[model samples]
Target: MAYTTLGDTGLDVSRLCLGCMNFGSERSWMMNDRDASVDLIHEALDLGINFLDTANVYSTGESEEIVGDAVASANRDELVLATKVFGEMRDGPNGSGLSRKHILDQVEASLDRLGTDYIDLYQIHRWDDDTPIEETLAALDHLVETGRVRYIGASTMTAYQFTKALYTSDIEDYSRFACMQPEYSAVARHEEANLLEVCEAEGVGVIPWSPLAGGFLTGKYERDGDPTDGTRGAASESVRGYFIEENWDVLDEIRALAEAKGATPAQVALAWLLHREVVDAPIIGPRSSEHLRENVGAVSVDLSDEEAARIEAPKTPRWPAAGKD
Candidate 1:
């Protein structure tokens, strides 16, 4: 696994990060494969995957506890641990947002659950429109100064919220978000509007989640109409099971390009994002060890100009909103 520096911060992270949303209780509805999750986490680290993305709300913090156990014995410096906050953990209003009380309270809670003293990259899981951006920044800055957090980032943010964050950081001398996480895939190209432009100019590492479009680009659904049937469709056991006719057309084009390159569609999809200048890394969420291997295999897949061009954005419903245009 090749490591890339996160923007200019000098924090080296693997180009592929393992998202741990399925680690704990969040695994309940999304992932009932705890044993598989644990094995995948260890194997990913063995494969030189140093970055592990988790969140407080994932499985209601059980995911953190699970991830905390996965790398308990590993050297801290050898890992690039990242997790998120700002999701509701309590019913009261104080339980959520980027407020100082919430931020400070959640940091320690995440630390305790993660079994670590400090977080490598602490991201606001989502933008808190209610709180002042400065208050959030000041609280985050305090975390850095006190050694509770090494760096800060944001996730699932709109262009407007992100712009304010940048200005607030500049004007207030608080720690700027070193990176931005958003859903970006061949199918979900919504972030192309202004987020990508700002991230490119500001040098914020763009870590794209769902590069596979929630398994849409895996090519597994190419045949048998959809992978939404039987075992694979358990997650999305709807009428279409997360696969539809239009998505099939888009997936077909990508598959043809992959076949031409002797690669899988999933690999080709990730390579497209990896080649983009704005992207620093693409978060790969897999359910099994086999999927982990397949996802990592994408690192070696290369796409030519023509092949890359063949995999353009289609007129489909975008889920991630990070790979717009």
Candidate 2:
């Protein structure tokens, strides 16, 4: 497992972060079995993957508990454990968002669930329009200062909002967001238009979620065929949005490139993101041990500039790519 620093920081993380969203029973497609989820996480650790990304909203914190159980015996000092805030964790007023009350409350809950005293990276799951960015940044800054969280991050927001947050952090002496978690993939290139440039200029690390376009670039779903039952495309309208002429075209090139390179389409797609200079890691959510091992293989599948361009040639870069807020 190749490792890289979480941009602008000396912190080392695996090239592929293990996303823990699937470790709970919130959805039918999730790995509902606790033992199985723990086993998959252990498999990832065995494969040298040290970065784990989870969120308090995922299965209402069940995922974090499972991650804690799985990593109980591992060397804690070598791992980079990350989880998110700004999601509805309970009912009523203070249940969610990045308000100081919510941020402070959630961090304790997350630490308890993960069975860890300090989180390596704590991220806001989404932009909170209702709360002032100042309050949110200040709360996060408190976390960093108090040693509850080592670094802070943001996910899936407009470029302007991100810039403002960074600027605010600079002026307020708050803990700036050190990384970004965007929904980037071979097919979803919206971040390229604006958000990515901001991250590049600001030296913020990017760890993109859905690097496979929700399995679209895996070559599992076809334009003329119905989505297979139990697949994300079959259930998620957002995932189904990838079933377009352009993304299909991108998948075709990806499939061809994978065959030529003797690699799986998933590996090729992830490798495409890995090729980008601004991307520090692409979070991989694997349901099985087999899937975990296959995704880790992307670190070895080197892609030349031309090969990477072919994957991008089919899709034009656009702002606020489909389903992204």
* Residues 227-323, model 2: lDDT tens digits: 9999998988888888788888888999999999999999999999999999999999999888888899999999999999898897888875554
Clashes of each: 6, 0
Off by over 4 Å in 2: 322-325
- Per residue, candidate 1 scores C-alpha lDDT tens digits across 11-91 of 999999999875664433456666766777899999999999999998788888888888888888989899999989889
lDDT for each candidate structure: 0.82, 0.93
Query: All candidates' TM-scores?
Result: 0.91, 0.98
Candidate 1 wrongly placed segments (more than 4 Å): 27-29, 222-227, 230-246, 313-325
**lDDT value, residue 185 of candidate 1:** 76
Error of 1 at 21 (Å): 0.9
